[model samples]
Target: MTGLTHHFLKMNGLGNDFVVLDLRREPLALTDALARAIADRDKGIGCDQLITIEEPRHGGDAFMGIRNQDGGTVEACGNAARCIGRLILDETGKDAVVIETLGGDTVATRADDGNITVDMGAPRLRWDEIPLSEEFQDTRGIELEIGPLGNPIMHSPGVVNVGNPHAVFFVDDADAIDLERSGPMLEHHPLFPERANISVAEVLSPTHLKLRTWERGAGLTRACGTAACAATVAAIRRRKTERRITVSLPGGDLTVEWLPDSENGPGHVLMTGPVMLDYEGDLDPALLSGAAA
Candidate 1:
């Protein structure tokens, strides 16, 4: 753990940034405390998540291990997938690549428009799959509220598990709500056993929606890819928007599409967005050893 210097790439998708370390060649024993130090903005690289590119356990191009800013390991990350996919595609000179995560294998392809589209795989809609504390016969709208009993500020959020758990509250105006205050409370709601990502969505039209998200472990992010996919599916399920629509987040826009179930098999959610490389640097040994906060 001491005297270790790791090369990392700083990347972002719609401003949800990450500090990516390639562990495929030289493995680093990454601990939770070390991850937190690496993600620290003041003392470390500062990112929403710390991404490690490891040798694929499954039959894929590479494995993506994600650690939130809090240093907790999570299952999936849509934005991180696209970023890693782009790196793999560029490294291997391939049009498409499969990135493995704890959630599943996500397929990222080079779109004709020069963006990356990630197949987030099939969403889990069942109550147990989303794994609510109690069983709600219908998950489209659950009995959760944010205010007084009679008059609540928010209620009946549509829940979906796209890679990870999410609850989308469709509202008239997404910007009107103070997510900074409500996000943390909702993310730790007792109903969500494993906690959840909370999103406030406003349907602008059949093809467009505005959204803001309180990420589970990352707090209020400029953009959250899985949240976008979850919101799009929830909107389509509620008949509020078309299957394919543009979701505008605080950082930028992402296109999400929920393909219908057909003869091929179950449907999958696709998220397309732009990725950017900000910079690359080496992690200081003191930071990794928790000597620097």
Candidate 2:
């Protein structure tokens, strides 16, 4: 793979940054090593995830493949969707765009406020769907607690799968707990078979929430769109917040709206946020060696 050079766009949704490589026309083989090389903060194009745009196999505009900084592939990444969607919209000059991912299809639209809105599809609430190691009648409050017996540091978290697994821990303060310490513990707990994104959420009001996420593979991130959606849905399920709410993250705010299921259709989660293109550049020829050498 020497002498190979690929052009990439650096983009971000809120602060969840990504390095997007369009391989729709010129396909390039991606491996875990290459993904890690691309995401290395000091040596390569730094990003939380490395996104690849490929020709759509289904009826969507394009397909997006996501790899975390750890070089692990995942089902979904909501913030990456908005960034890639904005790219497609700019190229085609269309208000709406469709993107296919390993998780499922996502529909994105350019909103009037100059932001992107993505329909993340319906969340998977079943225990098996979230792929927990065991079954639970109610995922809203699973029998899981941390710290001591009488005085637990974090308790019964709501679990959901918005394309991927997530565990939302509602707390009085989002920043009080040390996510770097607790996240890895909860994420690898036996309860979650496929592991899970760990979120510490504090309800600010009926319509507002403060959230922080420890992404499964990326660790602590400034923002996570799917985490926000999962947190909001978890809050609503617990009667802690409204269906539509604003979630504040370290990077910025995202508006999430969950429409209830009806006879006509199923439930859907819509996340709205901003995407910015930081720059465009070509990959160093030497970087690809990490994939094969």
Candidate 3:
């Protein structure tokens, strides 16, 4: 760990916390234990995920590597992208940036509306893409019913992979359910070996929705970027919403467009939102050491 220096930035996208580390020039190596150690709030600088910006690979403007609090790597993180985009822009003084993540290449544009628009790319709805345990001819809606909620009430979920596996439960009341209590169960449900982000969403209109989430690996979060994108896709599939919709999460509202590629539709879903800088600091060895100890 010699010659190690970690400059960190604290930021949030609707309260989905992140510890931003600039590794583009420093090239820090990350391990799960190290990630956990640094994410310890009481003993270390806490965050929901650790985001490292490194040299781009395969012809993207920038590259972002995301690790969950439990020390697992995940494909997409909406809030972090905006924050990282701003960070990169501040450093490079550019308005738009293309970065690579484990899932795929995503485009982020710093809009004048004070919102950053991230091209989340087209959603993958095939059974294998959602990567369900088995095959489903039509992935628009699959079956999984939790009793009491009714065997048929919540039976079918419109599944999709918006960079990460997601199962959306379109409910009538986004607030009626106890997300904090139910989120952990659904997130780790056997159906998704990779685990999944659980969303309880209520459609306010064809172009509007309200959502609350229990994010896989991160538990109940104020906002989940992929979840919003997935929900929008699901809503469109069910004919509940149009291609472009306003998804309101606990953190705030995100403008999500499905990008159908039709003459009147979009080719890439655009997620427009904001990232706020809460603070800035560096990780001290003492903090990580204490967490590990």
Candidate 4:
């Protein structure tokens, strides 16, 4: 080991785990092979993602950059932002933090509800932006289907990209279908060139929703922050809700609110959720002792 010197922190938001590397000082880059080697559970310190902190582009807070275990780069990760914010707070003793992502800016606030609230910026809902293979007139409900459940009439989905691409299918039952089996097919589906996170959502009422997600590169995550935001916006656009809602996932719940911007402000989404301080440790060389450079 070169003793390249990496300061690592372990954190999770509602069981969505992460391994954070503080790189704001001297930005470091990970190659595809290096990322895969680092994400290996047996040969390396296991993690759903490898996060790096960088200097912020906007005027305030810090930036959180993310790479999946599979070595894929994505715009934003909601849970990771919360964990990163907590780490920044612990170090700085600040109540708020502004996190930067490839997608945009997200401002985080520690709420009395024992969780963090992040203003996740506005969602992108254009056919070309979502980058579906074909241009569609309507994105609220795109005509992409899956297995027995994805046979058009049985499975019509709403496609939206909240930094990362997502296809949310409104279902009557969250457990009635198998997401693990179908997530891969839809994520790598021909439509999404950048691939996408597949989400199954059930709107219980005007302000309550339930969901299960198959994240691109990450597999079936207990909870996904952007998935919740996508579902809420899709539901609202579909006339299923007003503007705000509580989305329940296997991991936990996150409150999503879409607020109108001021005359000079841009519209944005607010996602409030919790982040946990998991045990932290360094990556013992022994863990990746067998990894080839």
lDDT of 1 by residue, 1-293 (tens): 67878899999999999999999876888888888888899988899999999999978999999999999999999999999999999999987899999989999998766689999998999999997999999999999998888998889999999879999999888998889999999999999999999999999999999999999999999999999999999999999999999999999999999999989888999999999999998888878767433
Q: Estimate each model's TM-score.
A: 0.97, 0.98, 0.92, 0.91
Q: State the TM-score for model 4.
A: 0.91
Highest TM-score model number:
2
How many residue-pair clashes does candidate 2 contain?
0
Tell me the spans in candidate 2 whose CA falls farther than 4 Å from its real position: none
Candidate 1 vs candidate 3: the lDDT winner is 1
Q: Any idea what lDDT model 2 has? A: 0.93
Root-mean-square deviation per candidate: 1.4, 1.0, 2.3, 2.3
Q: lDDT order of candidates, best first?
A: 1, 2, 3, 4
- Per-residue lDDT over 105-175 for candidate 4, one digit per residue giving the tens place of the 0 to 100 score: 77788876678888888888899998799999999998777655535423668988788888999888888
Name the 10 consecutive residues with the lowest summed lDDT in model 3. Answer: 146-155
Per-residue accuracy of model 2 over 1-293 as CA lDDT, tens digit each: 88988899999998899999999866788989989999999999999999999988788999999999999999999999999888888888887889999999999999868899999999989999998999998999898988999898889999999999999999989899899999998889999878899999999999999999999999999999999999989999999999999999999999999999989787899999998999999999899866669
Question: Where does candidate 4 have its weakest 10-residue lDDT segment?
Answer: 284-293
For model 1, which pairs clash?
none
User: How well does candidate 2 score on lDDT at residue 58?
Assistant: 89
